[model samples]
Target: MIIDILAALFIVAGSFFMLVASLGVFRMPDLLTRMHATTKSGVLGAGLIMCGVMLFFVDSGVTLKALAVMAFTTLTSPIAAHAIGRAGYFIGVPLWDKTVKDELHGRYDEETHVLRSPEHMQDKQDQP
Candidate 1:
């Protein structure tokens, strides 16, 4: 009885987070913010849903598969989101007008398409 209740709660919470993620994608002003919402909330929702599934099943095979899937999602989602965001930025996707700051402003080289750290830029300036 307790297990069922716990599973139900997790499932409901997961569904709610998934809904939030969907809303974020539609409502966020820019690509980066949308990606952030989808990655973080989506991963959490998936993890929680898997947890509920694992609990409800109470079987070793289902539990193992659920854990494996959860692990994969946790590892890949953030990296994928970052790569997409970086690609968008490289291709000149504009940030929202109200953005507070752009940390990558002068750090990225257009010609080489490489991002240099502040220390590296400083060292180059010192060399010349």
Candidate 2:
């Protein structure tokens, strides 16, 4: 009985997070922010839902599959988000107008397609 209740709780929590993530993706002003919502909240929601499903399953095989799915989702979501964000930025996707500053402005050299910090921003700013 307690286990069932626990599983239900996990599912409910997962559902709530998934709903919030969905709303965030639609409401966020920019792609970067939407990525944050999908990567963070989406992962948590999926993991929690998987946990509940794993607990509810009596068969060992089903439980193992659920665990595997949860692990894969947790590990890949952030990496995928990062790749999308980097590609978007590299293709000259604009940030929100209210963005304060871009720390990556001079870091990426198109000639080499590499991002490296050269000591400090102040050092670069001090130069011509």
Candidate 3:
């Protein structure tokens, strides 16, 4: 009885987070904000679903697979979101104006001196 109750609660919580993620995907103003919502809510929702599945089906192989799925989601979702956000930034997608801190801006230029292509480097050498 207790397991059933716990499973129901987890399923409900997971569903709620999934709904929140969907709303955020539609409602967020920019790529970064949407990425944040996607990563956080996705991870949490998957975790809750896995927990509920484990509780509802104790000792089953399906539950083990769900656990693995949850683990993979936890590891990869944030990384995928970050990669997309970084790609968007590099491609010159403008961020929302309300964002206050842009710590990455201008920092990559200082860290790396090689901005142009090898062809440009060859041209520069040929000029001298």
Candidate 4:
């Protein structure tokens, strides 16, 4: 009876997280943040739900399959998220400007760093 109750609780909790993650994916301002929320919460929510189902069911084969599914999800979710984020960046998805400091900005000379003017060196030295 207690095991059943615990399993129910886990499933409910996992479902809630999954719903929240879906909401976040919809409501987040940018692709990167959405990916962050979806990837982390989706993986954890599915993992917990699978654990709950495994605990609640008595069939060994079903439990093993669920475990395998959970394992695969855990392994691939982050990779998928990373790929999406990289694609977004490559495709020029605008970042939340307030949240990021791009250190790479203006640091390089496209022609050649060695050919930079003395004024550029002076500007760098002037920065405290």
What do the candidate models score in CA lDDT, each in turn?
Answer: 0.95, 0.88, 0.86, 0.84
| Tens-place lDDT digits, model 3, residues 21-96 | 9899999999999999978997899899889999998887978799899989999999999889987887779999
User: Which residue pairs in candidate 3 collide?
Assistant: none
lDDT digits (tens) for residues 1-128 of candidate 2:
88899999999999999999999988988888889998889989998998898778768998999889888998999999999998998889988788788778868888999887767656878999
**How high a TM-score does candidate 3 get?**
0.81
Q: Write model 4 residue lDDT over 1-128, tens digit each, in one string.
A: 99999999989989998998999888988898999999989998999999899989968997999899899999999999998986776556888776567433454464653334567877889999
Position 110, candidate 1: lDDT: 93
Q: Cα RMSDs of all predictions?
A: 1.0, 2.5, 6.5, 6.4
**Alpha-carbon error at 29 in model 4, in Å?**
1.1
- The C-alpha stretches of model 4 lying farther than 4 A from their native spots are 103-128
lDDT per residue, candidate 1, 4-114, as tens digits? 999999999999999999999999999999999999999999999999999899999999999999999999999999999999988999999999999999899999988
TM values, all candidates: 0.95, 0.85, 0.81, 0.78
As for lDDT, the candidate ahead, 2 or 4, is: 2
Number of the top-ranking candidate, with TM-score as the measure:
1
Error of 3 at 92 (Å): 1.0
Ranking by TM-score: 1, 2, 3, 4
